[model samples]
Target: QQPVQSPQAVILREGEDAVINCSSSKALYSVHWYRQKHGEAPVFLMILLKGGEQKGHDKISASFNEKKQQSSLYLTASQLSYSGTYFCGTDAYSGAGSYQLTFGKGTKLSVIP
Candidate 1:
């Protein structure tokens, strides 16, 4: 099932911080974060496994809480380049070596001067 992303949209000034949350009722095997600029394909940002450790790169970081079936993306000291639509794709194991990925509607993030 598709996850639900909170805030749906966000506006921040450069150097500001923002948080986006994703939640799903179904069990999750992993949560994948991606950023897609206008007219550009989504770009992989990070992935947090169900039992794996959190991940971070540059000003972006993410955490997964398997028990809660939720994930949160942290953008610290946000930059102009961070402006994009953030998508959280959730992967669920369906047994028999099958997995399904469902993406959230997306959270639009805009950075101001």
Candidate 2:
């Protein structure tokens, strides 16, 4: 099943912060985060596996909870370069070549001056 994302849109000023969340209906083996700018393809941000661990950089971070089938992306120190639509992709690994990953509609984040 496709994961559900919260806050369909977000507006922030430069140097602000925001949080985007995603939840899945089924047990997830991995979660992917991506950012897509206008008229562009999504860019890989990070991935969280079922190990209940977190991964990220100084400006972006993400957490995944295997038991809750949920994940959250944190955008700190927001910049104009960070303006884009964020998407959370969920993956279910059943068996060999029997896996599927789906993403939510996405969260539009606009950072203004």
Candidate 3:
């Protein structure tokens, strides 16, 4: 089943920071974050695997908490370019090392000057 994402929409200004969260009842094998601009395909952000943590980067980052069955996306020093809809795709272990992803509804972010 699809996970639940908080703050369906967010509005920010340049140089600000925002966090988007995703939570699921099922144990997640991995958490994939993506950003999609209007009329565009979602662009891959970061993926947090089980037993691991955030993939450190300059502006975008994320963390997976296996204990809480949740993941959070952090956008720091935001830019107008960061404006888009973010999605968290969660994969659960099906069987035999196979996994299937269930994507959250998506969080919309808009930036103003």
**Against the true structure, whose TM-score is highest?**
1
* Candidate 2, 1-113: lDDT as tens digits: 77999999999999999999999989998999999999999999999999998999979999999999999999998999999999999999767879788999999999999
Backbone clashes in each candidate structure, one number apiece?
Answer: 0, 0, 0
lDDT per residue (tens digit) for residues 1-113 in model 1: 78999989999999999999999999899999999999999999999999845899888999999999999999999999999999999999878999988999999999999
> How would the candidate models be sorted by lDDT, starting from the highest?
1, 2, 3
- Candidate 3, residues 1-113: lDDT per residue as tens digits? 89999989999989999999999999888999999999999999888998958775789899999889999999999999999999999999888988998899999999898
lDDT of 3: 0.92
TM-score of each: 0.96, 0.95, 0.95
Q: Candidate 1: TM-score?
A: 0.96
Model 3 residue 38 distance off true place after TM-score fit, in angstroms: 0.3
**Pick by lDDT: 2 or 3, better one:** 2
Clashing pairs in 2: none
Candidate 2 residues lying further than 4 Å off, grouped into runs, are 94-96
